[model samples]
Target: MKSLVFRVFAVFTLVLVAAVSGCGQKGPVLNVYNWGDYIDESVLHDFEKKYNIRVNYDTFATNEDMYVKIKAGGSTYDVLFPSDYMIKRMIDEDMLEKLDFNNIPNYKYINDSFKNLEYDPNNEYSVPYMWGTVGILYNKKMVQEKPDSWGILWDKRYAKQILMMDSQRDSIGITLKYLGYSMNTKNPKELEEAKQALIKQKPLVLAYVVDEVKDKMIAGEAALAVVWSGDAIYCMRENPDLDYVIPKEGSNLWFDAMVIPKGTKRKKEAELFINYMCETDVAFRNTDYIGYSSPHTEAVKKLPAEIRNSRTAYPTEEDMANCEIFAHLGSMLKEFDRIWTEIKSN
Candidate 1:
């Protein structure tokens, strides 16, 4: 009888241990990849607390960097933030999953104008996060003359005082615009002209940079720089001597949006996170922190009058009439990359 009792006690102990281990299992985790310094991190903490889930956040400096990682498929990401042209390229390649609006009701707060855009016409794949234009940021004290044209980037007087974006598309596209060619030009001759223009201007550039443009410009390290409107806003706030202007020759009008990749295993959790980001208070926090143009109508109304009225932050339709949105280049992307390499090498 004592031997029988020992066997039953051992079985009960084993069952209890298994039950305790099962209870300790963690909740669902969502992985998010976005541009560096793009969001308010407290938002991520709040999301975790509200949903009882874990968030693994990561950042990339450029769309190309993000693309290479996702394409390599070594890791899984639940969400991504990519700009307009990259979104179109991903959609064309069937690399993204269609978002279910049923899970994203807060999407209604997004302005109608930001919807049905060329990148995601049906609004099935992505949600607009921020929109802005590319332009020149210059130091008023350093530049004796006002800069109103892209030609100023190539001036010999400013040699070693000019900072250009290291991005392949922005660098090449702006050079094409400066040369009176379409930014999306697939013509070999126009591309060659752009390559030559960049090669000619290379001698004048201080350094090719990305986010570093903000600190360098604010510290008075460079006289002029090619920058996004959002960065211009932040830099101007930090240093009153800085100013931004869209060149008379025209520039690229761009949008960056949040998307779900095809590999995400937690679609429901991913959609929940996206919906949370679209909430009015969350949207306001993100826009207020990043200083980017918000697509949320209610959030825009909540911004300070100065920001709402500022021409640099919210450009008028007339101001943007000459601007163009970048289209997916398909196979032409290879040619652009090749040209960018040659220009960099020279």
Candidate 2:
């Protein structure tokens, strides 16, 4: 009788400890993974406090890195922000979960131009986050006159003072665009022409970088560099003389979107978060923090006049007509990657 009583008492103590531990624990938790420095920290803190949910934020350097980790399986990422091309690739691989729109009531505020994109047609998979173009961020005083052509990147006077993107895809794609070929072109001759152009310009470059364009440009390390729109905005703020312009030879119009990863346990919570982010004010806050253009029309209207009117932030419609977004090229990616490695190796 004594042994039985002790066993029963021990089991009851264990059960009580488990129940107390569960109650003392925090509220719902959401894991959000995104690009580094991509969004405002205050916004995240505010979201967490408002919903009483713990948000475990994480970041990745590139889309490829993000894709590899998610593909490993059983990773718990409720939301992911990736470029259009990556989103298309993920969807093709069935790696993304379908979004439930009912929870995302603010979806209607998105601009029509950014909606129903080719990658997520019918609006089933993702929500557009930010959209802008790749262009030249230059120092106006050094150049004297604004460059209107891609050829300016190879100007002899700028030799050893020019900077270029370190990204293989973006660098090669821009070169192809400058040469009047499709960024996704598979033509061996066209690609070779672009390769030659890159080599000719390589000697002129100070450095090839992805994340340091703002710092280097601010410090006047390079007179000019190929930069994404968001980085250009931040760079302009870093130096009063700096300016951003889309080249006459055309440029890449890139778009990023938020999508739920496959097998996310908190599907409803994920949708709610997406909807919250899509709100006009919330989108504006994100753009202001990251220095990017907001694809949400309502959000754009809410921006300060200086930001909305700035040419670097909101290019005229005519400028936009000259840009193109990258598309998934299936088998050609390996070839592009091969050429990219060759360029870096040499």
True-structure lDDT of candidate 1: 0.92
Candidate 1 lDDT by residue in tens digits, 106-199 = 9999999889898888989999999999999999999999898899999999999999999888999998998888888889999999998899
- Clash totals for all candidate models: 0, 0
Best by TM-score: 2
Among residues 3 or more apart in sequence or in different chains, the pairs in candidate 2 whose N, CA or C atoms overlap within 3 Å are none
List ranges where model 1 is wrong by over 4 Å: 1-24
* Local distance difference test values of all predictions, in order: 0.92, 0.86
User: How well does candidate 2 match the true structure in TM-score terms?
Assistant: 0.90
Point out the worst 10-residue segment of candidate 2 by lDDT.
20-29
